[model samples]
Target chain A: MSAPFTDAQLAAFLTGTLEDETLIDAIEAAINADPALATRAEALASAEPMDASVREAFAPVLDAPVPERLIAAATPRAAEVVDLAAARAAKSAAPLPTPANDTGRSSWRWPQFGAMAASLALGVLIGGPLLKGGGAGAPEGGSLVLASADLTAMLDSAPSGQKTDLAALGEGEVVLTFRNADGLLCRQFLIEGKGGTTSDALACAGGNGTGWQIEAYGRRAAPVGEMKLAGGDAAPAVVAAVDAMIDSDPLTGADEIAELGKK
Target chain B: MNPDDTTRQALIALIPRLRRFARVLTGSIADADDVVQAALEKAMVNLEQYQPGTRLDSWVFRIARNHWVDDRRRAHNRMGHDDIGEMLDLAGDDGVAVVEASAEARMVRAAVDSLPPEQRDVVALVMLEELTYREAADMLGLPIGTVMSRLSRAKAALAKRIAAEGTVQ
Candidate 1:
């Protein structure tokens, strides 16, 4: 009965910008009546999120090393210090690597800055099963090995300042506690694994409250004797991830105790 | 840090998004990088002109779009070809993983690439980059109503082309 909606009206309806409720009802009624209109509307709605796929296609570019040419171009230089030809020569001599390959699974191959390279390592090392490995009771494939369910229990229940000897599981302690942007409580721990390998990890409370999701992690050689430093000594990637995701600074000693008390 | 240093850092952070926008606009990675390089240079030289509180990404995006338009004009004059031919060339050369995507995905990409330059620009900013319509209008120096109309027409055209392909398959 109602006049068929125009393409613009249909588009507005799809984008949720069409505020006319009466018109929207009319359009819906029309669409229900007309199979062709329904098919077109469905196609448009499905195609709308194609941007997500586009973003995914380019996601690797975010982790790729920022090209030296762009970095140099962005760097501020005084007039007297400018040498345009030399910069051009350097750019041409060391061209940035291309992003594509035959199989199209582009590797992170560019010469990355120290911090970004460390972040790449952290992402590669901890991104898969380790992050999803849940808490101590999580299925086997997790990088962290617990001595007993007790250590897992302690990790789940330990307060920010609670320092327990995890030597039986792996020599380390739960060093810090804070909340992430999502307001989930998180713990940072340093552990010495087999072969004197030290790893630092940040784990946030999983949704069900029974486990944790490892948000960031890194591994390096352990110091000869001393326990690894907590804040400053953290891996660059780990520190950066924490700084980005943490809602605020690590809870103060009293605040941490109070937080633990509530749990 | 000085204002230049701060702006430079911000620009560095924005490079990935800018590159993505450029790829969509130019429809080729090589041309997209060239556009990005030129725009970054222009923005850096004129960093003092950039206001402190405004959205820096929008400003740079506008610069990139302007540079793209200029390059298109020059290419048109040099080759004695119309914009449609150039757009077709770009669609053919869209090297953003044609081999890896599904046939449907490639079809959608090609359909987008085949849009008119004005429509394609609007789609890239509003759809791909997820800019608000008002922001896109501001960046493109068009009225908001014009942007919505162009986007409406572009989406309809893309849907039609994709449907035709589906039917053929």
Candidate 2:
């Protein structure tokens, strides 16, 4: 006998905001009696905000690599500490002669002092030597840069979670594969060369089939007595970079293989 | 470990969620990133004011919401613009599998975007961000009844728009 419920009332009811019990009962009775009203109410209930499609649209961003600037902003001012630790470790390894004039190589025993001098001298030349020559295939400046062809093959065809034989192509091993925040396929790899030096690098698929772009690269600081190789666990810096960019969990083994096969 | 470090770690873990919420609020990727960055800087500056043993996510979300509201006010003053609907489109360059899916997603975003700013904020807080009604009200400094009313209206408006667009069954 009561007037039929309006769409706004029904919506409020669906959200549990409607308070009048008698009116609520009437609306319920009307919904049960009229199939049209029931269908409308069902649709209204299902189309809530943050629906599946909306969430799906954002999946790539959720899995995206966090931007480096954001990471830098969030990271504590501890790089100096890390550098000191590295220097101390380096110093204790070998006995060095004290400096004669208190200005030159004698102060090199202090890692910070030596590093400052080295930086001032090689500030411009630093990034140059770090760059590797094209197709020379040698690890340069402690980190290994993957060749375009090999990097492409690994990103396109290599299954994640399983180590692939990258030895034939280079001195590195593919540790894992994941999708960055932008939905680009990314792989984390470790390369070891002479003198127990190791490097961790993250590469993502370039746009328009340009092959992989190395996003982040860093040397794995060896412990005082032992060198750590890239394995199931990535270096802390590499992990931080990954954490910044990853919006979701890395793909499962089956999912990674299937995704690789798609390309 | 320093308390700041712990809070910083927790904040870092919440970045993805914050980014998603920012995307919804700003309705533009570039704007969302800027808002997030600004909120982060503000939070870091006021880190000492944050109460320990409380929900850091909610705290930071409030900061983000405040920053967004302030940014909108500034934009409104500078541009003398009231057209907030233009930025609602969230379609990205990533290739979705099916065209139909993409269209439906766009429709959903547009529907949410069409709501009035206050209503949209409530929807973003309660529905999209999965905050409880009380939490949303607390974040928005509104009464519980007001939050529910706004949400109801938002849901109704969205349903009507979606139905009218023929994007949903």
Candidate 3:
């Protein structure tokens, strides 16, 4: 008990890192012979500080079979190394980076360009069919005919749920009809281009129907199953736009036909 | 066995220990796997650079620490905060463990988890991993005295917290 060993000395002695053999022997003898030294030495043991609770808390991690994902990561693979933090962030946010939302370049000239629309500056590589111009093509990807007279004509003429193929804009269909804030008639439309490329747009035009401007435009992969556009789902962004602009419950049946018929 | 196969086997054998160590670094079971995966991938990529005859576990431990540190930094830089609560994986196993640890281990884990990252890491390396002071210093790139002080401080803090919790109960 007179062995005057500090906690550090006791720790070092317990770990067998003490260079002084004589002192080590003396401490071991004293610890074995003296109850107090034995108690302090026992507490200084590496496993002692960790205690039984920590052992229980940690033992399952050791006993549980290694997850398959972990085993795959350990094996040296040639590619598909993910950025762990970025992956975690993405996982926290939403769905995996599927080509569904790959058309990140906003073909829409967003009016007022508020916070939600500003999230369109994505680094996703644009893919899918070109915006085939009335001529040959606009570009392979990323560029589309945002606004045009042909689109305006389609907007004025196309009946709801009926597909209208425009010279500039691909096969387009008006899904629903409503009035914009200015009482100008607004039409929500879906256009499908080649290679599974799809655009959902809402446009407002006046009586002459010559001045069609897109109020909201969103690009997403066509939904699974049949490609019907009447009373169907739309991307949240496009839905939000319709929610913001619609001044009345959507026109239905003969009323919608009468509105389009006026043009 | 070929050296490559041998190395792979050794790395595989160390997974459980690595996993245990990772759980200490990240409180959640899932985040620990993320850290472990990133570290192992990095180790495999740089396998030739790993000096043979040296401790494979320690080398991978260093890699794991680096990966976790880099992940935290990237998360902080992107989010403008260091909380990293959202960055961590969902603690599905933790809920089950908490139900199990309702006896007393819950308080122990809470105390351990509450320790600062540096001290907590020290505790993991010394108390859990059972590294000597010199080995931990070498792996962490910290001085031996710093390792000793941190480990000692962590031990004292855990003891104090557990004792205080016992009194309250």
Candidate 4:
């Protein structure tokens, strides 16, 4: 605040970093004598000030309860220890030695080849699955192969309310769900456009499908009770709900086969 | 409790705070969660290397910072520009606390959200968390002068951005 106090001292004072008692008194004394200095000091406090409302906007995240799944996920298990060791050993095998002091290896020359090889390896590792029609990683549990003629006919029918809404859509897809080995429902879908502007959900239990009421007029992912529609055709949200319902055990083969006819 | 169990419990307890820091850093809850999960996994695997008396929160946060920085670098390398615009848009024009926001408040929030990552991170650590310069420097692995310069530039930039928004309003 004082004319003699440097901007550094003033900044330190504004940030609550000035710890010396003598310096604090001198700064205050200088600020009191010159109203302009007081104004300058005050300006420092308000400069780049945080808005109260921005803090309020994020306050909920600061207070929201941590999900149980996240808690379970955070806990380290013996399996992770095993995985970590294996990963470390895999890494150590290369060692990236100090080039052995030019033992027929130019540091600069080898680096370029090494990088090219790594990139090629990465490309192949990622591209191999995509080229195979759908990777094995594609959610497999929720796929319900429906053989019902009535349901198949409805999908291709012109007047069965199955026509996709093009106006309200930018990019969207319909999700299909079915049980998997883990008993969790998985989902897949055909996205119409770039950003899922017109997507369909094929869930049967909770989330966006079951727990919340789906409007009667909105396009549904698959047929429901008393409506014989496609099996394994639901939204990802619906699939999540179905997965949540079957937590511990896989849905039996007979029950899944029966769903194709009833729904 | 076994050391493994104790360490797990402590790490779990830090998740909320880690998430808060991550939200400040990434400006998106989904991104923040991803950062937190990645940081937690790294911390668990490297638990043996962590000194018992040191602050676990700071250690984990360092990992989060590194992970996000690496992600930013990779994204820049691949896309040639930060594609976080989609993430910012995902929260929607109407945030969850709309009832409390007036037109002016909304403008301020938008301005904060629009800040560049470098400036945004300083505000998150120094202003929001109130960390000392030395502590922040250590956390970010930067010199104290570098931290001050970054914070100073950030403040100046925020002033210009806010003034511009006020003029528009």
Candidate 5:
């Protein structure tokens, strides 16, 4: 039997749009009976292309610190509010209206950007999240994180196993220490924010004292409908980045102190 | 919240997904953000046309797709923009086999990039964006059959190209 099914028919089968009942049944039967045909069917099914990686293809962008300019552009002013510039100015200055009330959802308050980071918006269209002094900032833009003085000091003196509950920034714990290829020291840390917001972060020494460049950060998955942009896939992305830079076993006690002192 | 505020919050939430779609359309992260920025500005200008309670992502995606065609998608062969290949490593850090798969995914993306503009639009809208043929046709102002034809042809071409890549490696 010459089973001459056109690509459209197969695609329709994949998309569940094939109109003919007989052909649909036949294709389903064939797909069930033949493994090779099934594989080809999935590939041709463009609705979810690339082995169903459609949802994941550009996921990195989802976690990249949103450009503030784009945020301004996306915000729509009221009917009488014709002054877009003024609207954007107001939007950025004030925290966005509070997220879900009393339901105990993740409180991702729109963080205020430090003045220096705000100025960078003009020149950089794809800059990382310019976190305020106390928020858990995203770690992407130019691969540089703006750490607060306290955070930097902690990175400098905090022990590998110690956890510090910081106000507004969340509870931070230094997980381990390692040396990058530059022979400079790096440390992996975890931040557990109030209401269950968790960040697994890595920072390396260098980029000037107190710069404490955040190499990568991952938020533990928050529930999807919480109005927060959770980079659920970030943990692996951060781990992969650290793995590339990781050389010797993580430092302990005295060894960690020696590395920290040099930084 | 007021309507404008509601719309603002909703749009903010979608920023990530919109940026993701823009990346798919533009390939490079830099270029993709440019498209997203343009699309957002355009979307805000035409805000009244947006119907609340409808799919905001779809509406903005329509806007973004239109803007992509009119503006930067055709911007001089995408020079100076960061190469998207570096950003395509969404596949997790496994061993060598995972890296190879990611490399192949990049090759597939390149193949998609090489497709003719019209076919590329059909693929982006129907296949990658998961829009229905009717929706895609409406957005492109073409007949559903035309969208289907383009999709079929594009799928065949991608299959052929991907097979070649698999063998080459």
Candidate 6:
């Protein structure tokens, strides 16, 4: 027991990577065992807030236009869809849609070829699947990817419409789906552009097992399917994921989403 | 609406973040934007096999990484993939304003730019984007341990670079 935890583990803990309860507990134990480590953790936690100017500087990019070139490259699926301007306007005037609801999903249609291009774009935007040193290898200044197979396996782990929380590695696309116990269809997807960019979306509906596509892009992005889920079974992706991981019994209520996020 | 079209739009919406990530990886906002644009165009062409239930960000990032690597290969320079040798050359590049930076900020930015692409990506994903190691590692397709070590080394290198510049001042 080399003091229970190492500096590297502490750093990972600071970044919220130790999500498992046991790992967290172990980390806590380690910190408690070493006063210096605990102090260091505290200092890091309270470290100066993001330099006000730095945050302000980055804010523009966060709310900036999607770039005309990017807009032109994107194929809109619906005539009624909002453009980048409208999306930015909406984001400014309203609090971004909550994570708890199915508010983000919209609809669109485009040429068949556009779909393939969009899928690649989605892969870059969504980031690659989670794997150990396989898909993409971290280069001198960039990260590496795991093998393609591991990428595929990670893709298979999510429920319908559940976007894998991956970062853009190199370039790869992932399609994900799973039905919830209530029978609703859910799907989330991503495509990477040739320039190495990534994109994503989510959507869901009732337990009818019907397809509620959770993806759409015109000038602005939209999620697929119905706009809401009732009684805590909403976010078809979350519900579906819980359903797939269960050895027995379906998840219900808030617990379902909680468990799913944990995964 | 064609199902694929809908998917494209959703994915496109993620570009701003992707651009931000790219900037971190390439050390230049222009290069990052270009990389992201290229990645997006490529991803759209391969949507059919995309299975539902996968992490979208990671998938896209993988594409971006590939594009970046390809660019590196094309440039005929492959040294320092993980080692932080050169800081970002802030003095170069004619695109994107320096964001009201002080002289020291410019120096810091240059140092960041000089970092090898590997260290650069880890810093961008973990420090700049605030991604979890698991999330960052997943995006990069590396083991969590690899990510940890990379990040550890990156921080040390950044500190050294900053310290070195300070000595010059």
Query: Candidates 3 and 6: which is better by lDDT?
Result: 3
Q: Candidate 5 lDDT (Cα, whole model)?
A: 0.59
For model 3, fnat equals 0.31
Alpha-carbon deviation at A225 in model 5, angstroms? 38
C-alpha RMSD (angstroms) for model 3:
20.4
Compare the candidates by TM-score and give the number of the best one.
2
Estimate every model's Cα lDDT from 0 to 1.
Answer: 0.58, 0.57, 0.59, 0.48, 0.59, 0.46
List the candidates' TM-scores in order.
Answer: 0.43, 0.46, 0.45, 0.44, 0.44, 0.41
What is each candidate's DockQ, to 2 decimals?
Answer: 0.09, 0.09, 0.14, 0.11, 0.14, 0.10
Docking class for model 2 is incorrect
Q: Interface RMSD values for the candidates, listed in order?
A: 11.2, 9.7, 11.5, 10.0, 10.3, 10.4
lDDT of 6 by residue, A1-263 (tens): 34556666676565444545566556656554555665555445422222232233343345555666555444442332223234434533433222332434321112221434434433432443321111111111101122233234334344433334343334322343434444443333343323333333333332232222223221112332232211111222222222232232333335445444433
What DockQ does model 3 achieve? Answer: 0.14
List runs of model 6 lying over 4 Å from the truth: A1-60, A77-263, B1-3, B76-105, B163-169
Task: Put down candidate 1 lDDT per residue, A135-249, tens digits, no spaces.
Answer: 1111111222222343456566666545565544345567667887677777777655444455667666664544555555555433434532434344433444454466755
The C-alpha local distance difference test score for the whole of candidate 3 amounts to 0.59
Candidate 4 ranges beyond 4 A from true positions: A1-9, A12-54, A67-69, A78-263, B76-98, B102-106, B163-169
lDDT per residue as tens, model 2, B129-155: 767666786888875545655666666
lDDT of 2 by residue, A33-83 (tens): 665765666556544443455466545445555655455445553553354
**Which lDDT value does model 5 have at A207?**
44
Error of 3 at B81 (Å): 18
Alpha carbon lDDT at A131, candidate 2: 22
RMSD of 6: 19.0
Poorest lDDT segment (10 consecutive residues) of candidate 3 chain B:
B79-88
Question: What TM-score does chain B get in every candidate?
Answer: 0.80, 0.85, 0.81, 0.75, 0.81, 0.72
Model 2 stretches with alpha carbons more than 4 Å out: A1-54, A57-60, A80-263, B76-99
Per-residue lDDT tens digits of candidate 3, residues B1-169? 6675578779988898888788778766566777787777667646777888998999999898887787677563221211112222223344655554544655676788878889878878877777776678688887554565566566667767878887332
| Per-residue lDDT of model 4, residues A1-263, tens digit only | 24587778878755535667567666655664666775566556533335344454455555566755346445655543344344334333432223233433322322233333533322222222222222111111222232223222332221212334332222222233344433333332222323322233332222232121111011233223332122222332332333333332223345433532333
Candidate 6 chain B least-lDDT 10 residues:
B78-87
